[model samples]
Every structure is written in structure tokens, then in C-alpha cells.
Target: MTQSKSIAILIADDDAEDRMLLREAMEENHLPNELFFVENGEELMDFLCHRGNYADKEGYPLPGLILLDLNMPKKDGREALKEIKEDVNLKHIPVVVLTTSKAEEDILKTYDLGVSSFITKPVTFASLVEMIKTLADYWFDLVELPKNPKL
Candidate 1:
């Protein structure tokens, strides 16, 4: 499969275990895209806006896609998602919700907040590997993302 090596992926999840698992899954899938992680929604926003420690754009390049979790400390995914969608500079980047919550309300809410897709976290490691592979294929290989002038 053709991979977009230049496009990085940012994941916002409070759970360290989940982040490690996702990294493992991505490694298993052999995706060429660089993966970055943030433990909270606030950090995610900082990374996106290039504030605080993320001020160096070369060190923390803007992600082409974002995988966000619903529950987080300091600023939940919903709030962060709203802020991202409202910002003209960030709205173009696709944000996907990959959370464990199967609540219909969360699904509807995220979509309304301009999330590209909402996916329930897979239960098994094997399933996660498959999901990561599919996600990489769809976003990097199939989809045509907008060129960020800022980058």
C-alpha cells in the first residue's frame, strides 16, 4: 500500500496504556506516518495551536489527522473538538473520535462538533491492529487531505 510519509498523526487520549497499545498497533501495521501523543485535551490543543512547549513547529509539526478520546482531564474531547472546529486554521485537519464510550449521545455530539468519524475502541489487541491498518489505509492512502499552507 502507498503511504503518505509526510503526514503525521496526533492522538489525544488520557490513558497511558491505551496510548502504548495504539503505538504498538500502528507499529504492527507498519504505517509510515509519524505518530504523536498527548495525555489530555489541553495538551492536544496546545500542540495544535503551537502554544507552550509546542511552540517549535519543526519539533511538533501540525498533524494531518487527529484521533481523540472523549474523556480527558483539563478539557474534554467535546470542548477541544469545538475549539478546533471553530478555529479556521485548525478546522481543515480531520479529527476522528476513537473512544471506548458507545453512548449514542457522544456519537451524535462529536459528529455535530465536526468530527470526521467516531469509532468505538476495539476490545481485542488483534482487532486494534486491524483497525489501525484500516485507519492508515483510509486516511493516508485513500483520502485526499487539504494542503496546510502554514506547514
Candidate 2:
């Protein structure tokens, strides 16, 4: 269950501006991968679970990496992380916490919940782009992610 190759990166953030910025950064960095977006944790879970509209597997492929934002409406990232880590099939996917909060408690909590990494959202667009490059380099280049079992 060895998605070593560059696979789709799913982002679950409530902020439209943040999502747009992330997309722009990925594009600016020329990351050759698909980018999927979910507005909140509920939507994120729905996407991952392939429920309802996401029932079509081909249309919504399993993500190799998940960039999860900590705070969101309707089932926050913490809850989503708990569910994902508890599930046998979904636990394999790498979940990186990318959020604006730099609280130690949040960090500790997410790490304890089994998040692969926790990244503080950069304020500036340039800084964000740099972060995205580094993230792409690490996850897509250096690290070998767990293979997508659903694939």
C-alpha cells in the first residue's frame, strides 16, 4: 500500500485566498502534479472516503499526500486527523498539517495524532512559494511516500 512517484496533493483549507496562493505557488514552482482542494475537514473526509459526489474513483483519485489546515468549519483538521489515523486504509496517506497557527499545543496535538509534518503558513507570497518548493522537494523528491492502496 509505494506511491513513491509524484501523486496528487490534496489541500483541505477553508480559506479561498490561501488555497489560491498554494495553487499559484505550486504552479510557480512548476510542480508536475495534480492539486486537489477541499474547503473543510468534512469535505476533505468526503473526498477521501469517496462518498456521494466523490464516489467516482477515477474522477477523485486517492491522494498520495494531504496538506491539511488545522482550523476550519465543520469538522476541523484535528478531528479529521484522528479519523484518518484510525482508519487502516486511509492511515497510509501522509498528512502534513499546514496552518497559520503556531501554537505549541496545536503542534503537539497534531504530532500526537500522527501527522507526518506540521508547517506554519507563511505570510508573504514569496515565502509561501519557497515553502512550497521545499515541500515539493522533500515529499515529491527526497521522501518515499507510502503507496496509495486504492490505486
Candidate 3:
């Protein structure tokens, strides 16, 4: 895989406000990566598998990294993470659990399920901006990720 193509950051979150906040945080941090949103785990899976609306590869490019929210209406992040990790085509993408849950069980379970990291959503917007900056720094600048050939 080549790193020349632009890769998006796929985010799965049920809350509209949270998604909006994340987008604003990304903007504040100057994270230029394209961002995609899925309301639930089922939609996230659909997007990754290139099913339904996500079949248009050019419009919905495969994400290099996933920002998953654990709690959702259907199929939650735990199930989505399991499916992504189990799938051969999608397993290479790094998944980071970004959620409001600070539960020990959620953190431990996500890590055990092969999540790259589990981060609790910061309450303040400034903190979120910093978190997004750090995340961008690590994933975009520091690490070399597999680029999607289909893009």
C-alpha cells in the first residue's frame, strides 16, 4: 500500500452533538484529514465493508484510522471492533475507542478486543482540541499506516 492517497478518519457516534464537537475540535487542532460519520456500529460496518451507500469508494474512501464510540443504538462499538479486527480486509486499520464511558470494564474489554487505544471524551472543548492534536500527531505524523489501494 502506498501512502500517497488521502485517507479519511471514520467516526462512529450516535450523538449528533458529540460528532459536531469532534468536528469542531478537529478544526481547532488543524487536523486536515477527511472525517466521516456513522451513527451506529451497523453503519460503521457497512461503511468498512463497502456495503450500501458506502459502496462508492471514491466518495467513501477506506479509513486509515477509526474513532469508535462504544455506546450506540445498534451493534455498539464492541461488536463493530470485533468484526473489524476479525475481517482480513479491514483488520489493518487502527481503531481507537473514543467514548464518554470511563468504565474500567469498557476500557479493558476494548483493549482486549484489539482496539489501538481507549480514550475517555474530555469534558472541555480545549481538552478535546488537545486530544485531537495529539491523536493527529501520533497517527498522521509519527506512524506509517497502510494506505488503501482501492482509493
Which numbered prediction scores highest in lDDT against the true structure?
1
Candidate 1 residue-wise lDDT at 123: 96
Candidate RMSDs in Å, in order, are: 0.9, 2.4, 2.5
Segments in model 3 whose C-alpha atoms lie over 4 Å from true places: 1-5, 149-151
Show model 1 residue runs off by greater than 4 Å. none
Model 1 lowest lDDT segment of ten: 1-10
Give lDDT tens digits, candidate 1, residues 1-151: 5646888899999999999999999989888888899989899999999999999999999998999999999999999999999999999999999999999999999999999999999999999999998888898889988877564
Model 3 Cα shift for residue 45 (angstroms): 0.5
Q: Per-residue lDDT of 13-85 in model 3, one digit per residue for the tens? A: 9999999999999888766678999999999999998899899887888898999999998899999999999
Q: Per-candidate TM vs. native?
A: 0.97, 0.95, 0.93
Which pairs in model 2 have colliding backbones? Answer: 2-147, 3-147
lDDT of 3: 0.89
lDDT of 2 by residue, 1-151 (tens): 0233459989999999999999999989878788899998899889999998788888898899999999999999999999999989899999999999999999999999999999999999999999998988888778877667843
- lDDT of the structure predicted as candidate 2: 0.90
